[model samples]
Target: MSQPVYRYYAGASRTSRSRSAAWSALRWSGSLAVALYLSWLALFPYPSLSGAAADWLGGPIHRALGFAAYIIPLVLISALWRTFKEGRAAGGVIMAAASLASLISGAGVLAVSTHPFGVSPASWGGMLGSWLGEGLATALGGFGAFIACAAVFLLTLQVVLGLRLSVAAAWIAAVAADDFQKWRRSRQELATRMAGAPKGDDAVKDAAPAPAPAPEPVNVIAEKAPSGKGKRQPSRDGGPMPAASKRPGKYALPPLDLLKAPSGAGNTGKPQESEIKSAILALEQTFEDFKIEARVTGYAPGPVITRYEVTPAPGVKVSAFTALEKDIARALKAKGIRIIAPIPGKDAVGIEIPNARPALVVLREVLEGPALPPDAPLLSFAVGLSASGEPLSADLQKMPHLLVAGATNSGKSVFIHSLILSILYRARPDEVKFLLIDPKRLELTFYEGIPHLFDPIVPAEKVTVVTNPKEAASSLSNLVKIMESRYQRFQLYGVRNIDGYNKEADKR
Candidate 1:
C-alpha cells in the first residue's frame, strides 16, 4: 500500500498558491494601515482636515506617509519571501516588483511636500520655465525620496523576518525529509525479515526422508480355516484357500514409524519409525467402521513427533468426522493433536501431529505448486504455517484492507512482503497499483522497479511519508479527493466500478 500526500488548504478551492497570495495581501494591508496612522499622528496635531491644518501638518504628514509607503514594499517582499520558501519562485518575484512600484509612488509625493527647497522657485525664470522646473522637479524629487526610503525599509524588514522564515523553513524541510527517509528504511527492513522467515510446511516436509524403494510384489497364499468343522480348501494354483476375505478402502496407510511424535523436551529421543507407523495403523483400525483417511504428513526428530493429515470420503459431511475427534485423539495415543475439517476450500480434512523430524516448507515449492492459482484473488496473502505445517494462505478480499500488528521480527513484515510478491505475480501493472505508506522506510524499498508500483518505492514530490498520525490522516483525506474524482468519472459514464469505466474509456 502507498501512503497518500495531503495539501493544506482553507477549502478545496484554496490551493497553497492561493493561500500564500491571501496571506501576502493581508500582511500588506495591515502594514499599510499602521504606516498611515503613524504618518498622520506625526504630521497633524489635530484630527481636522482644514486648510490651516493641512498647511501645518502637510510637510510632516507627507514624510510620514512616505515612511509608511515603505510598508507596501516590505509587505510585498515578505510575501515574496514566503512564496519563495514554498518553492514558488515566479510568484515571489512578481510580488516584489509590485511592492517596489508602490514605494516609488510614495517617494514622489513625499519629496514635493517635505523638500520644497529642492525645486527652483517660481520667481527664478519665465512663467513656462519656472512652472515646468518646479512641477517636474517636485515630482521627480518626491519620487526619488520615496524610492530611497522604501529601499531602506525593505532592507531592515528583510533582516528581521528573513532569518526567522529561513530558519523555520529549514527545520520543516529537514523534519519532513527525515520522516520520509525513516519510512523507506523501515519498509526495506521489513522486506528483509520476511525473505528469511521459515515456512510452516517446510517443517513437516523435513521430518521424514524418502523411504527406500518398495520391494518387488510377492506372491502369497492364505490357508482357509475349517467352516465350523470342515477342512480348508486350496485354490487350483496350489495356493491355500482363505477362510474369510475382505476388501479395504481405496487409500492405504503408510508405515506407522512415519507417524511418530516429534522428539524434543518431552520425548527422550527421536521415536523410531516403527513406533510412528504402528501408532497410525492402530488409530486407523479404531476408525475402520467409518470411512476416513489418515496419513502421516510430517515428523520432527528433536521431539520425536509426527503430523498426520486426514480426510473424509466424498459425500461425507465434516460434521460426521468432527464427532470422532476425541475418539481419534485418544486412539493416536498422543498428548495433543489438532483437526482442520474440510480444509478451507478443499474437500479433504487436515490433522496435525507433532513431527518426529519437522520438514522444511520452501517458499519456492509453494510458489511453484499447481494449487497456487494464477488468478487467485488479488488480495490473498500467504500467512505462515498452520499447526499441521501446511502453508497458510489467506484471501485479503475478506479484509478489504488489513491492519497488521506484531512485535518486531514476529513475521509481520515477511508476511507483507510475501503478499506483495504474490499480488504482483497475479496482477499486471495496469490492473493494480500500490499506494505504499512506509513511515519506517525499510519495508518497501526493494520493489522500486516492480511494474505494479505506482511511484518510486521511496517517497518523493507529492508522495509523502509522514511520521505523525495526524498527517497520515490528512493524506488519507487527500486520497478521498482522488477517490471522489474517480467516482465522478464513473458516474458520468454510467459505470459502477473502476474496471467498467476503464473499459468504457478503452472503447473510445
Candidate 2:
C-alpha cells in the first residue's frame, strides 16, 4: 500500500510538470504566430500570396517603407526570437519593440532616400517616407540627413538585438585599458630588472668582496613622551605618502605621512555596558534618596560625553534635576555632569556625563575625513571631533581672529601644531605669509627659515626664530607697519578688505 501511494505521488508530480511545459509552449507558439503573420504580410502584400490578410496588414507597411517593407518582417522575427529564447512573460515587450523598430526604420530610410510624390512605392520609401524625408532634407542639408539616418539605423539595430551599445562599449574599453596597464607594468618591471643586472665584464669584477667600512659613532638621547592620563599606542596605518616635489620656488605641500593617525587601542569614547547600567542605577537611587521620582528612559553615547534621558513621573518638577547635578555626579563617581532641564526639541531632561573611553583625535584623521571641503584655504584647519564623534573642521577666513587658551598639558600646544601643519599641507611659500611669535619655543620655532615668513626688521640672512624680547618687539613693529601700508593701499583702491584690494590691483 505504501509503494502504491509513492507511485501515485510521482505520477501527480509528472502531470504538473507536463502542464507547466504545455503552458509555456502555448505562450511561445502564440508569439511566434503573431511574428509569422507580420512576416507573411510584409513579405507578400498581394492577395494572391496570403489571401486578404496580406492586403490588410502589408498595405500600410509597404506604403510607409516602400521596397524596404520586406525588411520589416525580418526585423519583427528577430525581435520575437528573444521572447522564445527567454521563455518569460515578456512576449508583448518583444512585439512592441519590433513594431517600433519597423516605424523608425521607415522614417530613417525616408530621411536619407529621396523620392518624388506619387511615384512608385518601391522607388525609395512610399508617401510616408517621402513626406518625412523631405522635411529632414529641408531642415538639415543632404549630408546631415544621411548622417541622421545612419545613426538612427544603428540605434534601432542595438534595440532589436537586445543590447545597450553604450554599456557594451564601456565594458570593452575597460577591459582594453586593464590589459594595456598590465602590459605597460610588465615592461617597466623587465626594464628595471635588466638595468639592475651587471654586464658580462662587470659581473666578474663585482663578484669580489670589498673591505668593510669602520663603524660610525653613535649617540642615543632619550626624550620624554607627552604626559597624558592613558598612554596611546601608535597607529597601524598612516595615509598614503607621495614623493615630495623637488621644484624650487613652487613649494609643494608636505606629505600627509608627517601627521600621526589615530590610535586603535581603547579610545572608542563609549562607556562599558556595566558602567552604563551602574550609572543608571546610581542615578535612580540618588533621586530616590532625594525624594524625587524620575527614571532614565534612554541614553546616547558619544565621543566625550554620554547623555542620559530622564523622564520624570507626573508632577515631578524639572528644577529637581538641576539642583541634584553635583550630587548625581558624586553618586555616579563621574568627573562632572551637565543637566539640561529639558533637551532641545524633546520632553525628557538631559544629564550628560564624561565617557570612560575618551577619543583622541589626530589632525591626519580630520584632514582625510569628508567634513572638510576639498577647496578650503590654507588657513582652514581641523577643529577635532564633536560630541557625537564626528570630525569637525573650520575655515579661518570666516573668523580672522582666534584665541587658544587652556591649562598646561590640556592640548593648547597640540592645537597650535595642528593649525601650522594643516597650513603647511596646503599653502606655498609665495601664496601666504605668516607672522608667528612663540615665546616658549614649544610652538612656531620649528617653522624658521623655510620660507612663508614675512620679512621683519632683522637682516635677510638672519631670518630665524625671534626668542629675544627686543627682537620680538622689532618684528611686531615691522608687522604693524606692513598692516598700515596694506590698509593705505585698500583706501587708495576704494576697497575695504584684502580680498577687495587684490581684485582692484588685478584690474589695474
Candidate 3:
C-alpha cells in the first residue's frame, strides 16, 4: 500500500513538470511566430496569404511610420529577448523614455533627409515624418534639423544601452596622460643625450690619449671629503654611523574607486504616498485622543527620516504635544522621534520619524558629489546624510576641538570611519597627520603603522596608536607645549596665524 502511494505521488510530479514544459514551449513558439510576422510587415511590401487582413493591419502602420517602421520589429525582438532571459520586458521610466525618444528621433531623421516638396506624397517617410520633419527644416533649416535629431538619437542609444559616460571619460583621460608622460620622458632623454654628446671638433681632439699629470702637494690639516660607501663610515667621534635620516617617499592618496559605489536604483528611496498618508492619519488621531487639535499639513521625505509639518488649531497650547511626545511615538510605532516646536522660519511644528529601512550612505558620494564644498579644506570630512537626504561635510580645522559623546552603537565609530576614509582619499601623509587615541583600542588597531600618523618614523609598536589613558594624557600635554611654542614664534614674527607666518617666512 505504501509503495503504491509513493508511485502515485511520483507520477503526479512528473505530470506537472511535463505540463509546465509544454506550456513554456507553446509560449515561445507563439512569440517567435509573431516576431517573424511583424518583421515581414516592417520590411516587405508583399501581402500575406490573408491579403485583406495584412493590408488592413500593415497599411496604417506603414503610412504613419514610413522608413521609421523598422524600429517596431527591432524593439519587439529586444523586449522578447529580455523577457526570455531576465523574466522582464521593460525597466523603469528611463527605459520607456528612451524608447519614445528613439521613435520620434528616427521619424525626424527620415523627414529631414527627404525633400519636402519633391517625390511621392506617401514617400518612405509617412505622414508623421512628413509633418515633423518639414516643420523642423522650416524652423531651423535642413542641416540644423538633421544635427538636432541625430543628437537626440545618439543620446537615446546611450540611455537604452546603459552606457557609462564616466567610464569612457576616465579611459580617455588615462590614455592622454600616459601619452603626455611618455612624450616628456622622450624629450628629457634627448636633452640629456645632447648635453653629454661631444661639442664640435674639440671633443674629438680631447678623446685622444693623454699623459698623467703630476700630483699636487697635500695640506696635512685639510679634511678629506666623504665619498660613496664601500664600507660604513664612522661618526666624527669615531663611533658607529648614526642612523640614516628617513625621508618619506612620494605619497599618493588612495583612489576613489577603492570605495564602493552607492547602491541606490537612482531613486530617492522615499516613503510611499500611502505610508505617509497613514502616518498622518495616525498622528492626527493620536492628537485628537489627547484633547489637542492639530493636523498634518505637509511632509518632507528623506533617506533616514520623514518630517511631517503639523499645524495646531488656535487656542491649542504647543506644550500639549511636547508633554505627550512618548504617546505620539507609541501611536506611530516609530523610535527616536524628534519634535521641533514652531520650526524656525516656519509657522508649523515639525515631527521627525525614523524610516523603516534607512538608506546606507557611502563615503565615495560625499567625496565626489556636490554635497561637499568645492573649496573645502584638506581636513574636511563628510559628517553624514542630513534628514533631508543631503550629504554634509564638516571641517576639522574649523572645529579645532570636538567632543564625541554618544551611547554605544550610536554611529560614533561609523562617523570616525568616514573621517579616516575621507582624509585618505583627499590628502597625503606629509600634508596632514592623525594623532589617533582610541580608548577602546580595537577601533584603531588596524591603522597601526599607517604613514599618516604623527611621529610616523617611531616604531609602530611603541607610540603609533595611543590607547592608555596615561599615554594619551602625556601626548596631549606635549601637544600643548608645542602649541605654545608656535604661538611665541608667531608673536616674534609679527604674524597673526600659521598661514600668515608661513607667508612671511617664505619672503625671508
Following a full C-alpha superposition, what root-mean-square deviation does model 1 have from the true structure? 31.0
Candidate 3 error regions (>4 Å): 1-250, 266-269, 456-463, 468-473, 503-508
Error of 3 at 266 (Å): 6.7
* Best-to-worst ranking by TM-score: 3, 2, 1
Name the runs in model 1 displaced over 4 angstroms.
Answer: 1-276, 282-336, 341-350, 371-411, 426-431, 439-470
lDDT of each: 0.52, 0.71, 0.72
lDDT of 1: 0.52
Residue-level lDDT of model 2, residues 400-460, one tens digit each, is 5788888989989888887777666556665667777767876778888866676578654
The CA lDDT at 222 in model 3 is: 17
Model 2: clashing residue pairs? none
- The runs of at least 3 residues in candidate 2 whose Cα sits more than 4 Å from the true structure, single-residue gaps closed, are 1-249, 292-298, 309-319, 340-349, 459-461, 503-508
* Candidate with maximal lDDT: 3
Report residue 391 deviation for candidate 2 (angstroms): 1.0
lDDT minimum window of 10 residues, candidate 1: 250-259
lDDT of 3 at 489: 94
List, residue by residue over 267-362, the lDDT tens digit for candidate 1: 343456797677668666755756555444443332323445555554557776678777777776656666677568755666555554545443
Superposed by TM-score, candidate 3 places the C-alpha of residue 441 at a distance from the truth, in angstroms, of 2.6
